[model samples]
Target: MFVQTSPGQSGSAHVVVLGNEKGGSGKSTVAMHVAVALLQAGQRVATIDLDCRQQSFTRYINNRSAWARRTGLHLELPVHRCTEPGETMQILDNESSELGQFLNAVSAVERAFDFIVIDTPGSDTYLMRLAHAMADTLVTPINDSFLDFDVLGTVDPMTYSVTGESHYAKMLRDARRKRRQLDGASTDWIVVRNRISALESRNKQLVAEGLNELSLRLGFRSIDGFAEREVYREFYPRGLTALDDLDEALGTGPGAEHVTAQEEVTSLLRQLKLPIDERGRRRAANRAEWFNQVNKPLDVHDILGAPQTGFQAGDRPGPRS
Candidate 1:
């Protein structure tokens, strides 16, 4: 059996798992973002992609490494491992192989990294359930619609209220219970409403209400996530994140949408309430202070009189073709 060690109990890495039973819920995207955020905060991070078939999370990390190499930009990357499924025809053998690889990966990084971010598959599987049960923090991202909300709870048609917990929610309850029984550790579950609409609508209101009601029963905190933005899609190609130094990476000043997206990501990270130590807090504070000052228009005296050392303020290059 895998060891059930609570995070911060004996300096073990805290486990954060991104999980959802249904597809197209932005699970990999959130996983990548969270991993990068932790790394940027000056915390050691390792990532495990449990979706051996799809491997979307694995590909994203590869793309980031490639983009960083091509552009010669410093992109922080976590120690990553992608588990492979068994090649055997027997179901039991396949499960055993997958479990061995997963356990090995966890053991290798458990005490080395400050955090371990796991990206689970869209569908239920043995590995997914195992990851969920070990998670110190579980983040579930769902689209802002009834179709996606149904994965967590069923809502009444007439009243638009939460009727009962759905299959995935029930599974989570069981996983959390098992985790407690194993190690007396509590999992902080957060449900993120992703791709939220900019304008208010009746559907949005109803979904919000239903989620609020469900949160009361499930004991999971609900928070807003990324809005429907094209920039998020564009970032995939370059493996860039909202927290990155966009002007230097993109070779142009970031637009208002980019700034807003960055703010959203920062807000979400804060809401996660991860156990960021003093060093991480200082690094994050320093980075925030730099970003705050970097955008202000520079005066002539400030630019002309300054020694030309390395990258200077107000000297960012124009947009790349």
Candidate 2:
């Protein structure tokens, strides 16, 4: 829900859509952590889980609620599940009435969130297009593997020539054209290189070179998303925030959750050019370590208690033409 701003709090209405046409791309994980980080930064954040089919963010929120209940950890994050008109359909014409209806639904909810983070489905869909149309900034996460980078373009085996035309590129070009046509939206598309290796590997360098070339030719800026680690896996059973693992226990504990969180947060800060002193880093690490050492996996129901009473997903009136 939206928060009425007071004199002291900062309000920057930024809508971020986490999207990629590839599956298993860590879109949900990045969305949840970014939402958590934004909350910690003292902004009123509202999450829109648009992936109704998988409900990944919804599940994470449920687990977060459970963990909060069992451990007395208070997370003031509000996540809303939004369903567009034609999400089930495989194809949608930009000029169709259904497309306009979906766009209006997103615009209506814009008033409720200080920062709206939209989590989109893995592949191309009507919902994904709607989100792109509404996005102020688009964050795309990519892994350090050649197979994963194939979505961007295919590299020739012998000569290493990169093909320009690909499914992902065409979709992006179409989205850009749509933004130009609408004339009110400008999308800042950020590419996050995910699953990065700590040590320098031959393959890593090749992928880096390929991405660099692609960025120069295509005009998309690059940033390090998250380094390759096991912490991502640990958050599965019970979702944990980036700072949630800042304590020492999380990083060194059985799950390696804390370490993973630390790497991800540090990488993001560096990418954004934000400063994080040593003391602040150490404190978070200790807390994570302690939590992992003393605690057990808590049920989501235990953390969050119960479903939010009287919350329903109903259609709002269409936007004015």
TM-scores across all candidates? 0.85, 0.72
For model 1, what is the C-alpha lDDT against the true structure? Answer: 0.82
CA-lDDT, candidates in order: 0.82, 0.62
| Tens-digit per-residue lDDT, 51-152, candidate 1 | 989998998899887887788766777777899978988999998989998999898777756788999999989899999999999999999999999999
Candidate 2 Cα outliers beyond 4 Å, as residue runs: 1-12, 84-105, 245-260, 269-321
lDDT of 1 at 318: 20
Best by TM-score: 1
Q: Per model, how many backbone clashes are there?
A: 0, 24
Cα shift from native, residue 36, model 2 (Å): 0.6
Tell me how many residue pairs clash in candidate 1: 0
TM-score of predicted structure 1: 0.85
